[model samples]
Target: MATSSRSASTPGWPVSGAQSRPPAAQGAGGWTWALTAPLLVFLAIAFLGPVLLMLARAVSDAELPSAWPQTAQLLRDWDGNGPPDDRLAAALGTEILAARRAGTLNRVANRLNYDLVGSRSLVYATGDALERGASVRGFADLARIDRRWINPAVWTAMRHAAGPRTSFYLLASVDRRLDGDGRIVQVEREQAVFVDILLRTFLISAVVALLCALLGYPVAYLLATLPSRWANPLLILVLLPFWTSALVRTTAWVVLLQTHGVLNEALIGMGLIETPLALIYNRLGVYIAMTHVLLPFLVLPLYGVMKGISAAEMRAATSLGAGPLTVFLRIYLPQTLPGLLAGMIIVFTLALGYYITPALVGGGADQMVSGSIAFYTNQSLNWGMAAALSLLLLVPLTLMLFAGRYLTKSVPV
Candidate 1:
């Protein structure tokens, strides 16, 4: 009984051996590994594996010019300043004839067409003539089939196509490309669209995150400070959005905000305005829709943090002669900042990749980075450019996430 009393009173002591449990790592090593393997495999197969593949595809060219040993060697030696010489052209013709006869002309054309616009039809036209036993003594027949065959730009594109991998897409994503002299140079100002779109993406996402912060702060404070019984109903209302489909919610907003929609009719009926407001299908619509959807992200985090703050601390500050503004700025705001930062980073990163909402609500000029990514991947069928754009957005988002995580840990609240 003395030993039992001592064991019961002793700090960190097990009452009895029968009541003991080993440290999980020490006792369940095999079980831990066995249970964790499926998750690791799932992550590898679904996320990490696809990310690595996208990274590789961003730099890889679909063309396999080297597969034609003689043609590749001939073109590699030719200066891309002007059109190829008759000998190199003859080699290209022979290879095209062989490729056409082997029923791979379409693949070859599709690859080259990515580099040069009319190359697909040019290949098909020339291959058709060659298959029909048309004479090709020089570049004359090839040029007649397609005027691009004699163009310097076509030679430049074809010269670069002689490799399995190239940085053409990555360079182009930044509005730079190789010149005839094989030097990296900026594309013309008229051709520089991605850079402006990228900047606009950052601007729009930042604005959306700021809007969420400003709006979510008040809602979260109310939820945290109110009596739990009172707040529960409002909290249910706030969470009602999640129960509905995101697409359905966005579509409803579109119907409500359109020119002849419910909002305008109500305003006009109430003598609020004579003219209908331009709200849907523009930057305004994007901001409103995204803010509504993502506001919960900011609110939930801020509410969690605010609930942890003691009312006694604020009362103590008041008793010590601090004004409401002073106590809030110094005490309350500082405590909630970690959660604010977390919520902003989450909303901003999500906004950077926003596609469906913007696509459905925003006009052409208001689309975000993911819109361009979808355009390139689905519409243009340019995987390299799409992957490059995706990487461009992901790198900065990852940096912000890590920096915010470090800040969150450092903040006391």
Candidate 2:
């Protein structure tokens, strides 16, 4: 009894042995890890695994090496200067013939075509010539098979591709490529579309996020300040869109924003305009649809934060001779900023990757990076390009998320 009293009085001291729990009870504490183990394993396999695979696909360059092993090895040593040597030319010809017989020449050709257009036919024609007994002892003989075989650009592309990894996909995604001298250069203005697409993606996402904040702040404030009877119904209305499919909502916007649609007809009946506005199939429609869809995301989080703020604080400020605008700007706005930042980040990141609404409602000028990613994945089957574009999209979002997290932590509630 004396030892137990001492154990209870002395902090950080071990309990008396007589008072300690059984060994079985002590072991039960380990169940915490056991309970969480399944979640850790699931996240590793489902999320981390695919993210690593995407990173690998963006940089892996195995097509040429897999299809033309010997030639790829030889080309790796070549400086990618003027032209290939006699031995390198002969090896390339031999490997092309071997790959043709093995039915893998198409893979090498298709990979090369990614670097230089028309390279597929160039590779196929040369393979056919070599198969037809066109002896290739040097660059001259290979050139006879196909004149493009002598072009430094083709050889440079081949040398660039002779790798266990390459930056071609990542570079191409940003409208850049290696020149014959192995220096990075901008692609021709005509071919430089990805940069524009990427900029347009960010611009559209920023606009949508801004619109959501502007439209959602008052709605969320009302939801927080109104009486419970009114607030409950209003919140349900805000959440109603979540129950419907995003695709269905987007399609409904299309119907409402079209030239002869309800909005235009209503305006016309009130003599608002002489002709139907070009609202649909443009940037305006993209803003309208995305803002409507993402407004709840902003409102819900902001409303949650706003509800936590004390009405007494605002009243105290007002009693101290503060005006309504002064009370809000100096007292309330700072408290709600973290929630606003969270909602804006959520809406912005979602808008960054938006594909369907923009594709459906906006014209050709409004296609985002996701459209290009989808085109590469489904149509062109260029997994590298798709993965590279995905990384470009992920990088900015990750930076913004980190910044928002820092701001939320630093700002006083």
Candidate 3:
């Protein structure tokens, strides 16, 4: 065989193999970078950056350490099994004098009081007692001012408060804590708020999702089964809410569902009731408004999925002597499962984060996790607790989203 000499400098190829390699690599890399840059920037600015900043604030313990670094450090070594050491007492005394001189004692006391009810008066009294020549020997002297000061539980909380950083806000969200001896314990029933809020949030979300699915299923079927001209217009109407501002929609619902609104007026006109019912400021109004807002989310997904399904299979089933209900249950319904699941996931996830509707329509008992988050953020200015609560909400939401995806993949079309 005559070996044709393959010149490295061939015009069709490259002078060296290395010369060809770089262009291919560069093209691939350039495309990857071009595709990924937007996503990375979006995540950095929108998702990851905010989340990290919020998480940092959750454990910040900003006020305590900024006010009394020495006292905080002294408490670090405290076992909290019994009285704190004299060094801790002295450190507290020193910090108190310094805080008083700096005029930050009241601010620090106020900050602590936000976390622990009545802590402001306790800290102020402790400072006064120290100034009046109270013995700075041990926790016993601190207890003389407020009996709660002696409790191991109180000391544990103090140690956390004195930290350069702390997990108190995170722990408190789940009704958990490091007790006096530094052992994790269930928070007292009266202090346990998050668990109830979490449960209520999930319960409300589940109810909304179910209601949406039930109401949307028939509507989606109608849209899918109808003529395209009619279905398209109806679909536009269904999606009309998306174009409107959420606040406006919620406010409209508030006005419409109120006792004196059109609904009650109609009821009275029809002689359905003797008097106007308590509709707006309750769970019933919350459900009504949320269902109205979220039903489209359920319908669109289901309608889209149902639209793609071939009608021939259902026709074949019907031709085989299968009844209408039987054909729907066996052939049609199974195909709509993906839509049902997607709608449920969307409705449930959105409902979990609902704030405005519940705030406007629901009473205190119906308030969801998002309402609690807003309360911490706006009312209390407790960003740490707000972030922790938000994180708690995120976990289950992420799980549900992934579970939805998994279901979509595993379920047969």
Candidate 4:
């Protein structure tokens, strides 16, 4: 008998068939982290780095504090109710001359303008006098460039702007600002724009999410109940648009809904109307395009939940004297609640930040929070306001993302 010796730790299996043991535990554990290290570094550099920079910029102090240190020291001690004193003007003039020689006056001017609308011109005029070798001895000589420098509002704005940090951008997001004394206060009624835009963003997103739910639920049910051979093709159709370019799809809607485009032309030729409908470049267009684009997001979640439900559950419920409605409401709907919530949250959050579709298909009046963020960043060059608005949009999405996971875990499979 050819018998093989076995170690005491070995299981009672054929010796030749035993699996080979690893030579090192360290390679399996440490090498796994080594493989993922590059991805972690890449994510830190590409995503987290920019987000941190944006947040830092959002709370950054006004440039006046650094650009004119002497003026800042003076402003720190002076009573804001007092006049634009000669010492304050002399310090600003000296700073402006120094800044012009250093070629960084424009940045200071831009910062000043953020505090007072016409302060940019004031800074520039002072800078130009200094650059042209005009001798400015004191506040009286500096006021020659602009009489507004002696004005109380200009001094008040300058005094308030001497900051190491500020909450101005964050406050402005909700239609608030600092008063002359640096106290937080509500903005004028006409200037109260973003709160309305924020509300409109929520309203539009809610409507689009509801539309997706209403239209997608039945289609998802049909897909789940159908045979796989039929359901596969239907599922492909649902996913087809999602695979296509979002820009292209939004553009297609513009063409179809435009006054003289395919849909309007076809309707006119069919004698359906005398004039083309006002569909494109309005809230109607925004809603229709957003709902279509988000419909698949809702469908996929519901379909996954529906497919998991056993047919035996329904039969058992019916045998227990449950009607069709009763079986669905009592027996099936409970199982699908997690999916329903997941779909709604996904659709709503996505719609909240939708920029391209709304910009392409919607009028200015129909634009959302994302549009305002873009306008502030690109057109107005207000990075702080843009970053704060982005925070507003991001916070809600983060909350919903966690809430979806918690709710999904709570539901019975």
Candidate 5:
């Protein structure tokens, strides 16, 4: 009593009780890699790679040792707690004279002088002052000519210059030190700078963000409530600033807000004041220009959210005996919170990186982190310190963005 065999047309596969299926090549997962390959490649080149390279420079002590490997190796065994070792001193003396003969002492001096005030001239003058056949004794005699060389600070820095690499610049920015005796200590309160700059940057960014929200809210609401024909045109007007360069816009503000500029002239004509007010080159000017530049960032996000909300919600609240303001506050405004948060974050982050407007319009007191970064990178050529300051800015910017994303997710639609 053999069972009959199933035909090819059977519902199940040839094997009993097994379902028929397409080949693995036909599955959705087969296309996943092909679709996401471009994104993976883009992130590697455009994001992660550059960030790692930039961060490396913060701790990179490249020049002083890489060029003089023997001198660096000789100094490695010398305990920096006391005067330099005779062997280490002899090697340095030789290197210094050789570098001087090659007309390259200025390069080394320039590198060391980055964080140290007035060390360039000291190095240059010492190099020129060296006599033929002069040994380590002459270099050590530098203390007699300049009392500053007697301080342990310069020696501590020289010890750092003998390293494979170091975090000295990063530590110095935070007012911490790796002393000649190989101990870390807090610098004097007055000598600490990065912490103050960080606080100032945060405060300025927060203020500018708040001001943008205040100015943009009413404009966003009006744009959202107006008829499409009117709203579209107004939105174009609001977005007009994007068409112009940021530098041009900042410069325009400088011209308008100057002591005797159009604003003052108009105020004087209207008899609003007895004399021209101090509008430009101050914190007030920084706030005004930054807010103006950042307002559209606030408005666009908020307008998008507001436009999505149904007028019926407000109408329903009003019909239930809630006042207009109450309806907006309890119903409409709650829905717009996500957008407001998003706008605030964007504006704040942009303001934190602001250099041009603040530099051109802001007085000495109003300069932001970016201005400091530029000063170090360009004028002072202290790449390590510049990188550290930049990293300082990046931390908060990243945290704010993360918080914004979390807030957006937790919001109720």
Candidate 6:
């Protein structure tokens, strides 16, 4: 009665205790976000911002526009029905001279080279002619400077690359290209490498995951089943890899697996073989080094999940006339599925992006997509192709990540 001034029935008054609690809850949530704002901002800037910029480069065609704006605009306006007109030709020559003088001609040349072989030479030669005051009054004069100028293929390459945005890099990543007729087609057999590399990436990841699973399960089981007095030291050993640098670990493998290294020496001393095994710098070496590097990743999660499993269920199943194998297969294994899948996914995802391990231990045939990304980034200086390859690598890894999460959640406990 004393509190009747604000009753439940009163409009704009709280209906229940739950409703009255909302302001404090909202205040708490606001404080939560306030506390986390710095971390969120850090992730956005440090992680998301660079990733987005890289992905944008996959579709970006800014080089031509940046270095040869007049020519890019003229090319955009020209219909691809025939060769560019004298006006476009003159504009190209003039801009080529300007770009060459400005030291940005390589930008335009490299972009066109992505589509047409020897286009860099074409662009450089033409720019050199124009810089020396060779007249380019018409398409014919421009064509005289380089016969490629008369070829529709070169014009088509220029037309495709004269964009603010393009799918050229993305298509090329998957071993496809846009032809002069603008039709999507497979790249030449010699150039059709990325798809195979992608497949090899998946194959290597799957095999490594499988190997980790096969090898890790027993180790994790031992860690889980052993008494704490005995398990602590083993657990420490399992976690030991985390304390070491991956570079050091991979180097250790290189030391061990090299032809004249410890393992081969030991094997030869035992009269196990007449020659040193081809253990390093091959797919076998890749598998060995990667599995060793990644084994701990698979074991730790599995050990945690395995420890949570109750012995009572196994006892009950055994008392119900179930054999040891049956109890394990029908009871123990299913419970471990979530962690098993989770750990394998983590291993596989990490393997897909592996660079240093393969680079140090694997041969040319064993190189993964990350190698191509590095080659483009460092060697070829093709940022668009690098970003495109990174994008392609991300797509499947993202899908596998989601699938792993779903399977981990959906698997029956």
| Leading candidate by TM-score | 6
Q: Check candidate 5 and list the clashing pairs.
A: none
Inter-residue clash pairs, candidate 2: none
Local accuracy of candidate 3 as per-residue lDDT tens digits, 255-325: 88788998888999999998998888888989988999899999999999999999899889999999999
Candidate 3 clash pair list: none
lDDT for predicted candidate 4 compared with the true structure: 0.85
Query: What C-alpha lDDT does candidate 1 achieve relative to the native structure?
Result: 0.84
Tens digits of per-residue lDDT for model 6 on 1-413? Answer: 75785664567756567667767785897899899999999999999999899889999899999888888998889889987788998888888898999999998888888899899999899888888889887899987898978788898888888888899999999999988899999999999999999999999999999999999999999999999999999999988998999999999999998999999999999999889999999999999999999999999999999999999999999999999999999999999999999999989999998989999999989999999999999998999999999999998889989988998999998
* CA error at residue 113 for candidate 2, angstroms: 1.3
Q: How far out, in Å, is residue 229 in model 2?
A: 2.6
Q: Tens-digit lDDT track for model 1 on 65-150?
A: 63455776777787665567788788888888888887777766776776667878888888888888875667887787667677
Better of 1 and 6 by TM-score: 6
Off by over 4 Å in 4: 1-37, 73-81, 84-86, 135-137, 268-274, 411-413
Clashing pairs for predicted structure model 4, backbone only: none
| TM-score per model over all chains | 0.87, 0.92, 0.84, 0.86, 0.85, 0.93
Against the reference, the lDDT scores of all candidates come to 0.84, 0.91, 0.84, 0.85, 0.80, 0.92
Q: Which regions of candidate 5 deviate over 4 angstroms?
A: 1-36, 39-43, 46-48, 115-118, 129-131, 137-151, 183-192
Sorting all predicted structures by lDDT, with the top scorer first, yields: 6, 2, 4, 1, 3, 5
Q: Candidate 2's residue-wise lDDT over 1-413, tens digit each?
A: 99999977887635678347777777776997899999999999999999889778888988899988888898888776567889998888888899999999988888899999999999999888888888889999988888887688889889888888999999999999999888899999999999999999999999999999999999999999999999999899999999998899999999998999999999999998979999999999999998998899999999999999999999999999999999999999999999999999999999998999999899999999999999998998888899999999999889999998999889886
Question: Clashes in each model (backbone N, CA, C under 3 Å)?
Answer: 0, 0, 0, 0, 0, 0
User: Which candidate, 1 or 2, has the higher TM-score?
Assistant: 2
Q: Evaluate model 3: give its TM-score.
A: 0.84
